[model samples]
Target: MDPNEPIESADSTPESTTNKPQVPPIPTDGTPKKKYVRAVGPNLKKLLYVVFALLALLGANSGYLASIIAMQWYTGETFENFFYFCMFLGHVALGLLLIVPFIVFGVIHMRNAAGRRNRRAVNVGYALFAVSVAVLISGLLLVRAGGFDLKAPTVRSTVYWIHVACPLVAGWLYWLHRLAGPRIKWKVGISYGTVVGATIVGMV
Candidate 1:
C-alpha cells in the first residue's frame, strides 16, 4: 500500500534471505579419509583370524613356560642349573611373548590394508616361531623323560646351546615383523620377552 515509502521487511521474509557461504560438495570418488575397509575377503580374513588366535595361544604358552622356569630356578640350589635353565627358558618364552603381539598387530595391519603387501618376513616369522617352540619343548621333554639327567654326555652343552639358539633366532625374525610397518625400531621388547621365556623354561 505504501509503494512510495521504504517497505519495512516482515518479521521473517526468509530465514536465509542473506547470502550464505556455500560448502563445497564432497567429491564423488569413494575414497574417504582413514576409511577402514571391512576386510571381508574370505582368505585374508581367515588368515587374520588364525594369526590372531595363534598369537593368543602362543602368549599363554609362553606365560606357562616362564612360570615353570621361574619356579624351578627358585627351588634349585646350584646357580649352574639356574643359569642354564633360566637362560634357555628366558630366551624362548620372552621371544614368544615379544612376537605374539607383533603377529597380532601384523594381522590387524594386513586386514586393514584392503590389500596386503609383502608378508614374506612375517610368514617366515611364524614358521620360525613354531619351529622354535617345538624344538625347545621337545628338548625339555626329552630331558624330563630321561629323569632330568641333562648332564649326560649325549645331552652335552651343545644340546643346551641349540636349545637356547633356536628361540633366539626366532625372536630376531619376529623383530623383523616390526619392519612390516613403515619404519624399523629394534628396541629390546622381543629380545626381552625371549629372555623371560628362556629364563622360565630353563628353571623348569
Candidate 2:
C-alpha cells in the first residue's frame, strides 16, 4: 500500500451484497383493475331453457286460437265471441311475459354463444324468435283493431295467417334448435318435453 493511502478497516464490508428487502410486486401501470365477473353458470342457463320452452308453449296456445278461427271459417262453425276475446287478451299477456326472458337470456348468453358449430341453428332460432315477436305485435294490434271476427269459412286476415304460419314453421325451427343446441340436463329435457306435449295437446 502507498504510504499516503488510508488503510482499510478490518470491519469494512460492501452493503450492495446484503439481502435485499423483497418488494411485494405491484401493478403500477395505468390500466384499471379488472372487476370480478361471474362466469356463465349451469343453473342460469337451465332456467333460460325453461323460460324459452314456456314461452313457446304460450305462443303455441295463441296459434291454436287462430286455428279455431280458421276452422270456424272453413266449417261454417262459430265460437263464443266473448270467449275468443278473452283468449286474445290471454295471448297478449303471455306475449308480454315471453318478451322479458327473451331479452334477459339473450344478454346473459351473448358472450357464451360465440361458437361456430351451431351457427346455422342459432341463426334459424333468431329468425324464428323475430317472426314470433312480429306475430305477437301484429296479432295484438290487429285484435285491438277488431280482427277476431269468427265468420263462416274464416275471413283469413293478415294477422291470422301470420299467427298460424309463424307457429307452424317455428315448430320445425324449435326441433332444429334442439338438434344443434348444447346438451342439457334431464330435468331441463323433461320440462321442455312437458311444455311441448301440452302445446300439441292444446292444438289437438
Candidate with the greatest TM-score versus the true structure:
2
lDDT of 1 at 26: 87
lDDT (10s digit) by residue, model 2, range 1-204:
699997779887656645667678777896877654332467667767767666756755665675676678988978637766776677777776766776666556544554445688658767766765666665554544456543433544665677667767766776776676656456966786687667645644
Report clashes for each candidate as comma-separated counts: 24, 2
Candidate 1 stretches with Cα past 4 Å from truth are 1-116, 142-152, 155-158, 182-204
- Kindly give the stretch of ten consecutive residues in candidate 2 with the minimal lDDT sum: 147-156
What does candidate 1's lDDT look like per residue over 104-173, in tens digits?
Answer: 5445544455344456754665565566555556555445443565667665666766764665676677
What are the lDDT scores of the predictions, listed in order? 0.56, 0.64
Task: Return the lDDT, model 2, position 112.
Answer: 51
- Model 1 gets an lDDT of 0.56
Candidate 2 wrong stretches, greater than 4 Å: 1-40, 46-50, 56-60, 143-156, 182-204
RMSD of candidate 2 to the truth, in angstroms, is 10.2
User: TM per model?
Assistant: 0.34, 0.54
Q: Evaluate model 2: give its TM-score.
A: 0.54
